[model samples]
Target: MKQIFTLGTLAAACIIACAPAVADTATQPTASAGATSAASTSESRKLNKLADEYWDALARFDPVSAGESGDNRYADQIGMSIAPKNRAHQFALYRDYLKRLHTIRRDGLAQRDQTSYDILDYELTTALRFEPFPEHLLPLNQMDALPVTLANYSSGQQAQPLATVKDYRAYLNRLTQLGPWIDQAIANMREGMKTGVVQPKAVMVAALPQFKQLVAAKAEDSIYYTPVKNFPSGFSDADKKKLAAAYRSTIAGRLNPALKRLADFVEHDYLPACRTSTGWSALPHGMDWYLARVASQTTTDLQPEQIHQIGLKEVARIQGEYARIGPKMGYNGPASGLPTWVSEQAKYKPFKTEGEIIDVYRKLNAQLQTKLPALFSLRPKTPLDLRLEPELSRATASDHYTPPAADGSRPGVFWSVVNDPTEYGSTGMVTLFLHEGQPGHHFHIALMQELGLPDFRKFGGNNAFTEGWALYAETLGTEMGLYDKPEDWFGHLNDEMLRAVRLVVDTGMHAKGWTREQSIQYMRETLGYTEAAARNATERYMAWPAQALGYKIGALKIQELRARAEKELGPKFSLPKFHEIVLGEGTLPLALLEKKVDRWIAESK
Candidate 1:
């Protein structure tokens, strides 16, 4: 959930999938170099140590990662913000580390270490881009930020443990940083304004409540009170009393007032004054900047127009598949217009209770696992579970993936509907399950973490590779035999169409200057979605302009690569090997992926 605030992209750092140990460094070339020259060996060890230090620094800033990895160096560190100055210092440290990493020759590392080094190098380079943009000027977006996350943290059943007074104190430290962070955010937004880079009015309006909620009403009622309310029985009375007072005072005096300032600035000052244009192209030299983003995210030099066209072709192909399912669902015409039929499917209606919806996904997961090995070879070790979005966030949240902690203590979680299940069409479940669950995110992400990749590769990722692989997994449903049900097969196609629509609409909004309503109308008319579904989906596109474009764009490149690999390898082609090659690389841009796949094909031949 990387948020596009007025300043920085709030790249919500999801927990990287966890592992059993320090990833068997005994096998790392730097750790065991019997054959390398002494100079190479010495340089190799130094580079490896720098790599470890990079992970340590990241985990320290990212409290969730530290807690998940079972690292106690930051155990008492909670609810803290990496100050703007500190963040700049962090960037400088990483730059210095990258220089050290480059000093070591790649030939000195093991095969595994080589891959780790390549991925780390990419992360360091990409991270350097953020330094140019002072994003801390505006940190918390209503859509995704600390306030929203803290509410989630307060729910007893999440990433951080809140059983002890120490945990409460950790949060207090983090929470206290908010006041200063918001001030910094304002400064950053002003900077953006100076450069004509402020967030779209739509984005700011959507985020207003986040500020209001964080600072709303009484201190006792704020979400920053779970530790005060749920302290462990063994806690001393003095610690408990003192922690409760911190929570109360922070919320009443500090948190609420900060929220008021932010909300008023957004709702009253920002939104009304927002730029009407949507695309990054609307900004000064935005076209070149967006092109860079496309290249960086997709890992390819493919032009935006080429991506736009691929989306068109895929949407049509999927639409044909949808037509076949329409009649079966009681529609009169070819199933091709299945979005309409899907909307009419009464059984697929929204749910009255959240528990019932979550339970059904859980059931589907169990049933699928029983059947998955028949078609797929990998699975996530993090126990997949269902959880509800916090009440405050439900209204804005979308179903999301929360990766397992570094210690494998928590399983990869597939968050379901933001609120009620009934809002989305029933036919979408198969496609949704395919993209987010089995053989999709769970397989690509979880399995990579298990393969002993460096921390950078495990925790940091590119959207195109990750999302593209999930969409590619959707087309594999027939191979798994689960799509034998016509409705389910149609469901998969509908999902594909949904992604295709994203490319057209996302490009239309940002690049083509299509209005928000126009995008909504286009999706509704073409995708067979209702007003609510259409609006929700479109707003998502508006909220994140280029991200939705990743799924179809990435998926097409992957499918194209597979066909080429199969054609080249011929009788040597192996699905498991193809999958292994794809997942084994962690996350690379689509173009980089093709290069890797081509190399794999050559090696297999």
Candidate 2:
């Protein structure tokens, strides 16, 4: 699943954190002896204001990000997220902020204020490192393409508002901006081809169907036409007629043509020239580029070889766990063979309808609610909605969580793809819900929004922390009394195995020069992934480097911290309070998180 930005394209990818427009209900922490003076208080306020200004400028520059942030001020605006000019502008913005941030003396700031400084500093520098790579050229993919994002937002199910005539007009404005953006994207890809920076042929091939699906012969059949069809209650008949006609004109005359052109270019022009090689190291300055991505995603100085070795160890451990569980589940198959056996079991694939699949998840959610308070002292106030992945996005989508609207207009949603009901298994339901719903992303993200943290703290996030926290949350499924059955417990290991396998295959393909076929084979043999599943996973790592590394790296760090906390605090250790501390300040880099928890440990002692 794609992280934070709903518009999962290149332009929106670099935005690691942003704040939702939530009321400031969270009180500031008390100042320590080092930070209690009036001067320190004034300095903290100055930093807060500076951070606000910084994020406000950022939200205005990228309308897609603003839309994701629940800031409707730029709702009518849509710009090319990865256009060269825009990239240059964003780079300059980061540089300017970094220079200004340097001018603010960091000494004697409150603990939380210091955290904001460090996170902002790290994010700014990390963003700058991305400037050297040709990310704009490889803008769209099957998992995070513009077509899927547009279809999702326009379906009246995402962050874009469609509640009033003004909201409808704003959406129309965004549609108008698509033609130029699409042209720019095509141009960037063409330039990339000349520079040996083209996307993998498989990715481009997979994206063709999505583009075709997005365009329709009739404007009324387009996903963009949905808002017009389902107009709000207050519009007068005249206004409805006028807006409906305008939407039809925009979708047919402007939007559909753009989609068709892009699809034709990808199928006829781009695909023929697309690179057959899967590794980023195949491109010019590819090794450096891959390393940059590794550092950015993991937010660490880890080498690929190091990460690969870690993955190897993790894979072996999870395999041992899987082996033990297989026999307990009445399967005599080897541990390496358990996933295939369970995937094919009739008892696991019991659902007959899509509604049944969704209902089963809802029941899982209900069961977890009664158990959440025991593990979490603080929970997100935002309501959680369980949904089926939208029809247009399901083919490319996985079961994932989408954050609540910053304005709380819509609740956070955990969507599972139900492409074929009978084939959808229930073995992973509890852990999936735990990871995507409460005590996972929903808890970490929504609580940040609800707490009224700075916009950067509220919206800005690193993958290691965000995804790691979710992976760690999956381990708590048993604590919640959800994974009692051996098959159910095995599903948790299967998922963990997937993350560990990612470490190996992602590093193998990118740094070790392993071919796509080799990576796929490794995944199937070691993780029990079917050939099709293995190929998809391999392609995903190929598309986004080092991203898969974050789950294991982050989860390991969190688990390590929790273990340390439990050991040091001894009888004083409180699971709920430790959870509160971990999530209390929102998403942080692994190092910052360690420091925060260490301070808490010291204070507890």
Candidate 3:
């Protein structure tokens, strides 16, 4: 199923549920407290059973998640997460679950069972901590607005199924269901305005066209019109005609008006009232919210200032590396000028067609496949595909990977943002593939799903491990022979530099009260981001605090672990074995990961 909490879900992402739900295992009671007692073992099993039931209930309540999980039982249900009543009920469920979990004796469980208990407890508590905040009021970001994701779903081109008559009807149900939710979304934003918890005007402005596109003047113009035009082959003409008529009526009558209402609300009301300040600290309890986000995203208690210092050190190191390679690229300047020179260099962007861009990705895949055996013994059996982002969503879409369907119907897909060919630089393509495709998300996410682990462990992830492993994967370019040339190496380092800059800038904006302009200027000066790119990147961090920090922080930790394993194991160190241990258990918090690596080291020795 899609992530029970998607990285794109505005409410979840805003509340930090998208991050790894890790808690203080020491303070919380675990079955290990029972010291191998039979009662403890029984309690652990009971808790496991309860955890499964909890997930099953959660999956049922979240329709998009249900469909993504490869379960179609709740395909017809569309949840109104932004509604006040819905939030209240969800919070109630979380409390009830936590209460039930606490009743279970954690003192007698085994190590594995204890870990599961801690994870579940953490997930529930992390979820509960946000209940006091009015995050639902600011549910739409430029990047992950509910309307945009719904449009993709209703279009029958995404995770939503459209194989049969029932599937078509299911989507129709979903569209009808979304109308009230969209209405509630507007109402929530209205509440946000009153409480000063609304999204920034810049973010709201970015979201304007997305809502406008959904509110088509003609039924045929609507994204929802896609299903009617492409009926299933097995559908009889009578059935197709009836469904088409129903869809057109639904689009024109219910959906179009609902979307128009939302579009008007956003443009006329929300936009003007949206906050001008970019930082979260500008809002009520904004600093605390940002702090919570930092802790959740990094899975650490490191303060923003500490992370900022770390970022500065990392930026300095990466700049030194970038400077060393400057003369090779025909530039002889100080490290500080490298970003500007890279921005000015036109030779880096070579692809003239969408085909040319995709060709490079496919070639990169082929190259990585051949070199896989040297570093990774456990490669994903699930196939990976490279495809362009749909033209409609290309405006906001960035290069990303979609994990394979849990049931294996869909292969892992690497979606390239090929909107404008000239804008697409060839220099970063190798590093991009390394991070998003093979041995990156495609490898890490698929392996978790492939293993018959607990539902939470399989699909649930912390941003740090998920993004960290991918960034760390970029560093693997050297070992895999992908970054052989200076340009390719430059691409890798340039991307690394951006992640480091994220540390400085994300904290600078939220904690230090840096203006949006200041953050954008820093990105352009330090990381070679273009003006447009800098604004977009800065806005993303503004929309979601501490999330950008995950890439560099995660990558550094993984690299550190690898170095420790290598140094301690000496000749006994096995690259493939080390990889197996790191990735075998799917995503973990950095602390747990370090412990796992330490254990592997001791065992190897």
Candidate 4:
């Protein structure tokens, strides 16, 4: 999972869905005296000031997101974002910004400023559309919830810093608020039961162990005790003792009991009320909600049926490639048999220890560095580091990338989850590294942060662009000569197939009334995944609807643009320049990206 903090989505359409309003506002007549160049300059200045103010207000509004991006001013605060009063205030803030934004004349601004205006408008409009939906009712899930985020912070290895005495005290202050947050979360879940917006029963069952793991009998045994055990070497014994005592008291008095209460609430009160139906359509007004998710996630107006058809076509196409390669690997079996044959081979599972797994990725990083300059004129200055996933998150987590801090305090890290070395497959290693490590997320995200763009573009993302870029990066493996072996190529296709499978399964469950078991069985037959792998994949989609649709949708769009550039430009084309154009601006919605690429092609001619 690539960690992206996406803004909300528009209802049932692309960003262009809101363009008529912008167009109307832009064309309104201006007063004759106020229509001079001075007026244009004033509007531009006002827009710039608004951008700055919005970023600052957002930092205070969602401090965790700000802290992750390397803003430390609000490190001690965790606002009650889900509470009704706070939610209302946040919506009012968006409405105010949007109202002020419309007063600026978009037609009079510079091209760059015009782009920023459109992006900000899209974000505000999309966010406001979600006001009718009650996302606050379900605050936590088996994956990517507040608890998982907080636990990652406690390790002292994530975005939260523990480098000084002040840093330690700030964290303690943050923990003091956890009890209330948990209580509110439980209260919200209870409200959800009445409103018919609850999570699936299986997801709640899966989340129980996560809460249980955090309820330790003693503070010293808690995961939050991590910082206390590894104090900075410069700390005097007196300071260390005092900080440790404070941590122990906070964890025992505030954190542990809160965690236990949450665990008990889920087990006793919430489980019986969870919805057994797997898809979003089962809830109130769910079909509309799922449609909104589709538009927002893919940044397109693609309907569920349209996306499902596209997935089917892509799956068939990839399966043909698999059949073509299967003969060369000395296996004349059917394309569906390829995954099993590859997995059963002892040669692919050679690692006896975790160290060997890390070594394999390090070597891939070294090999990739020498090949990057040939294809990319724009590369990130931020370094990419490899680390194993922490023990607590490893069970539920996949291999993922975390972006570097804005202040350069931390480097981007690719966490490889090595649960059991002997069971880890090696063929996927090359493509996995390509997708999560180097020229994939690290290159795109780190470079975006490094660019001199608006704060929203730097920190905000569209899932289609982010995941699509990573999936497209996997295809670059072939051009880079990383997939020299038949097995390696098979791994690439298999991973692609998983994304394709997601298109079928995600919509099937959420829009077409597919059961969890039905989805799991379809994955096993198509990708040759074991029952456990298939189940995990199904549950992930169940937890996050329409998110999986972005990978293949975004990748195909990029590939389409590249092919168009190649055919039109012929000998005049430069791969590096084309890449620069696609990635030069920070992340864009798919429609905006198409317009940008088309403009670049026209200019080059």
Q: For each candidate in the order shown, give its overall lDDT on alpha carbons.
A: 0.65, 0.79, 0.78, 0.82
Query: Model 4's lDDT to the true fold?
Result: 0.82
> Between candidates 2 and 3, which one is better according to lDDT?
2
Flag regions of model 4 displaced more than 4 Å.
6-40, 69-72
- Error (Å) of candidate 2 at residue 447 is 0.2
Q: TM-score ranking from best to worst? A: 4, 2, 3, 1
What is the descending lDDT order? 4, 2, 3, 1
lDDT of candidate 2 over 526-596, digit per residue (tens): 86778898888888788777778888888999999999999999999999999999999998878778877
Q: Give all TM-scores, in the order shown.
A: 0.86, 0.93, 0.93, 0.94
| Candidate 4: pairs in clash | none
Instruction: Answer with 3 or 4, whichever has the higher lDDT.
Output: 4
**What are the root-mean-square deviations of the candidates from the true structure over C-alphas?**
5.2, 4.0, 3.1, 3.2
Tell me the lDDT of model 2 at 516.
93
lDDT value for candidate 3?
A: 0.78
Q: Estimate, for each residue in 1-605, the C-alpha lDDT of model 1 and write its tens digit.
A: 21211123313221111111112223444524465666566656776787788877766665544453334346445423336666777678768977987787776765556656666666566566545544454454444565566566676455565656666776677677667666666666666667776666666766776667666568877777656777889989998888888888887788778767767777776666667776667766666656555555555556777777877887777766665566666666654455676667667775767776777777778887777775555555656665666564466656666566566656766767545555655556766777777778878766767867666566556677778898898888777676777677777877778888887887777677778788878887788777777866776665544666667767878898889988998888887778777887677645446667777887778
Question: Candidate 2 has which clashing residue pairs, if any?
Answer: 16-461, 17-459, 17-460, 17-461, 18-459, 18-460, 19-455, 19-459
Better of 1 and 3 by TM-score: 3
Using lDDT, give the best candidate's number: 4
Query: Per-residue lDDT tens digits of candidate 4, residues 103-160?
Result: 9988667566777787778767776766777777877787655666777687777778
The count of backbone overlaps in candidate 3 is 8
